[model samples]
Target: MDTVELARLQFALTAGAHFLFVALTLGLATLVAVIQTRATFGGNPVHQGMTRFWGQLYIINYAMGIVTGLVMEFQLGLSWSGLTEFAGNAFGSALALETMVAFFVEATFLGLWIFGWNKLNRWAHLALIWVVTLTAYASAFWIMVSNGFLQNPVGYRLDGGVLHLADFGAMVANPAALVAFAHILSGAMVVGGFFMAGVSAYHLSKRTSEQDFFRKSLRLGLGVAAPALMVTATFGGMGFGTMQVTKLAAWSGDLAAAQAEMVARHGPGDWLPPVGWVQAGGTWMMGLFALMLFVAAPSTLLMLFRPVVRGLRVWHWLLVAMIPVPFATMLAGWIFREMGRQPWAVYGLLTTSEAMSPVSAGQMRFSVIAFTSVFAVLVLINYWLLARAAKAGPAAVALGDRPIDAPQPVLTF
Candidate 1:
């Protein structure tokens, strides 16, 4: 492969890995915040345990996720400089805003939530986590704004061969970005739900003494899974309207017509994406969505009928099997999203072939190998830590320095 192909592969590896972390982080953070809120307001010890147990897992994923997220940004300047040269004014601004939200806002509040345990007022500590959740979503919003621009190229004008922002509001409100953000957030929720359910299942199947604890956690997981996936399927469908119509046309196996459309509009030499791969990816994602709904629906029903029937070992194993489903589904959707727009770094404005930096093939190959190796190590470490913590159960971990049976702090400052 030449520089462009190697560059595409490297970006794909980094972006795909980073997105898996992102899906879990966004969803798990919100769930942890909600759990903590319930604990603070209701004065429920069970809810407090839930918060600590799941929050630890969220922190594990979030730490590694930050590393991958920073690396993804480096690719824009190092490998795709042509994209920056053409659309830097628009893309760079959104990215700059995202950086501010991530470090200054999200990170600050998250630190408070983590270390503020037993040190701050109960209500104040609860509020900090919620702030972190919102800012994390804001970070995602800015990222989608940049990606949506690449897909739809709205709210911009070309002046002296450089794209300039024409309307900030329009860019922020881009239909593509809005739908994509919803889709992404909903997907994250599903991933989080499954993560919780799967971990709880492991403990329950072992017949741990904390049956009530894992059972509650499983209920919370199933509760979020069904609704979030329903929203994901809905908004994912809505997104097609804003995407490049010809790209969808090609993915639907109507490449001749799509080619004709592209050629007539841009005098294209070739405009076909990987047809087989796109079809398989789209099919795989939808199939998994269906499977998710099938499992979550029954599990949610069981939760609603709780106290009538305990969590069965059969159901526990089923949830364990689903641990990796969301990760696979998210990756498949990403492949469909990015690869389907193939041959264009910014749709219709710039072809991907022209957007690559003048890096030698050897340099691109080395970067690809190095990045992939490092990312693989990070992923393994993340999962290993998460599994170790989750299996340890709530009793084995403590948010405060004291034991679980120690005197609890009141809501006072």
Candidate 2:
């Protein structure tokens, strides 16, 4: 592959890996906040334990996610200089808000929430997590704003061959951005729900002593997942209507006309995206959504009964097996949304080939290998840490200020 292809592959791998951490972080953060709120009000030990246990997982994911996000930003500067040079005024604004405003405030608040666990007043600590949750959403919002501009190139004017931000409101309220943001948030909730449910299921299947704890977690998971899956599907459909004509035409089997129209407007070049990949991504996303919804909706109802909740070993294993489904579904949808607009870094305005930096193929290849290797290591370490903490159960978590002698098995393994 050439420099462009290698750069694309590098971005794809790093971005995709970063997204997995993000999905879990967003979803789990909200759930942990909700659990903590309940604990503060109701004063239930189980609820408190739930908050600490799940919050630890959230923190772990959030920490690693930050590193991955930084790597992604670095790649944007390194590999896509043309994108920055041509459209930085318009595109960089959203990214700037996301990083400087949303991300900065979020990290500050999360740090307080983490270290402020026992020292801070209950209400104040609770407030911090909610702030963190809102800022996480803000981060996602600004990012989608940036990405949506790439998809639709709205609210911009050409000034001496460079794009300038003409209407900030139109850009922020872009239909493409709004629908995609909704879709992504709901999809994150689905990821969170399934993760909580799956982890609880694993513990319950082992017949752990914390049956009540895991049981409530399983309930919360199914409750959130069932509705989230439906909402995700709804917003996903709305996203289809906002697609650029070339993408829409490719999906609808009208690529010939779309290509002709593009050539007529922008001059002779291939304008259609890879239809097979786009279609496959959409198909896989839809199929997984159906599967998850079908199981989660009914399982939500079934798990409400005492007998099914306790004695159904088969159901427990099923939930455990379905842990990875939501993650895969989210990734598939991302592929569809991104790859559907292929060959254009900024649709109709800038081709991806033009967006590449002036780097040799060898440099691009080396960067891809280095980035991919580091990302793989980070991903593995994240998984190992989360799995260890998760498997250790509530008694082993060290999130809050505990006794110094308290057995912190999660740290060891």
Candidate 3:
């Protein structure tokens, strides 16, 4: 395989795997934080147990995810330095800010929260968890902002070889960044909900005995999942509606300019539509996006309203399978977001071809193979580890102070 293809394959495989772990961490971390806060505030053992259960999973997933993520970061410089340097002024700020500022707070507060449970007061203890949670979300925000820039570059001016910051305020205030952050945060919550539901199901299937405890677990899972799923569905729909309209406006102008150019070149002889077809096409795409949103949102809300299904039987697998469909639909929406900006990496700043590295197409092919194989193996291992972790129950995996459990996908974004 050519190096370009190899790089693409590697990125794809590793990105998929990393998403599994990272999404879990984001969800799990928030969950544990919630539990910790509730236990401190409400004096509830159930919440404390919830904290312990999810905390172990959080640590396991975050550790692995950070490692995988670091590798991805390194690969960016090694394999795609061209893209980086080309847009470094715009992209680098977000990257460096995320790592240097956001991450330090997360790491430090996470340590304090984990180790300070007994040593700290009720308010302090709860505060630590919140700090960790806020830092984690902040970390995610910065990362997403950088990615939003990729999907819709803002506040950038093209220099001879690289893009420069035209306005930092514009980057922070980017409409795309706000919606992307909401989408990502909601995905994390959905992951946590799935984790709770899946675990509840596993225990419920084993026996009729202790049905109450398992039922409580199921309720606990749904408690977060219900609200989150509904809101996420709604929130994503609104975001897409806005995005769709915005895209229509953008394309309408582009097509108008293109058509005008054609008319100028061909004069009145050219078959330019008497009416502006560009506006019509733009409206059609907008409607299509709205249709996708309608299908995706209501269905996801339906998942929220689903009656609790306990047990690890065939039905449980079906539920798990059903869970990702809305997310997959969201993926389709993202495909629109990315592809709709076709032919340009940063709008009019640079073409996609210009951003491509000096590598052959054949290399990108082999890289895909390697990335795929590696991901298959990692996912298999992840499932094996999760099964073992669940077998032992949350308490066993998070005994005393440290973590020794395999990560679970619970959510993939």
What are the RMSDs of all candidates, in order? 3.8, 2.4, 7.9
> Tens-digit lDDT track for model 2 on 1-413?
88898999899888899899999999999899999999999999999999999999999888888988998988888999999999999989999999888999999999888877777888999999999999999999999999999999899999999999999999999999999999999999999999999999989888899999999999998899899988988999998889988888767777888898888999987888989978888889999988998889889888789768877889888998898899898888888888888889999999999999999988888889988988898899989999999999998887894633455445564
Which 10-residue window of candidate 2 scores lowest in summed lDDT?
401-410
Query: Could you give candidate 1's per-residue lDDT for residues 1-413 as a string of tens digits?
Result: 87898899999989998899989999999899989989999988888888888888898889988888888999999999999999989777888889886657998888887877778888998899988999999999999999998988888889999898888888899998999999999999999999998898888888888878888888888888889999999999998888786669756887787888889989858887787778878889999999999999888887666552254778888999999999999999988888888878888898898888988999999999999998999899888987888888887665554533457556454
Which is the better candidate, 1 or 2, if ranked by TM-score?
A: 2
**Candidate with more favorable, higher lDDT: 2 or 3:** 2
lDDT of 2: 0.90
Listed in order, each prediction's TM-score against the native is 0.94, 0.96, 0.73
Candidate 3: count the clashes: 14
| Residue 302, candidate 3: C-alpha displacement in angstroms | 13
Please tell me which predicted candidate would have the highest lDDT against the true structure: 2
Best-fitting candidate, scored by TM-score: 2
Model 1 compared with the native: what TM-score?
A: 0.94
TM-score of 2: 0.96
How much lDDT does candidate 3 score?
Answer: 0.61
Which runs of model 3 end up more than 4 angstroms from their true locations?
Answer: 1-3, 111-125, 208-213, 241-343, 359-375, 401-413
Q: List residue ranges in candidate 1 displaced over 4 A.
A: 307-311, 402-413
Ordered by lDDT, highest first, the candidates read 2, 1, 3
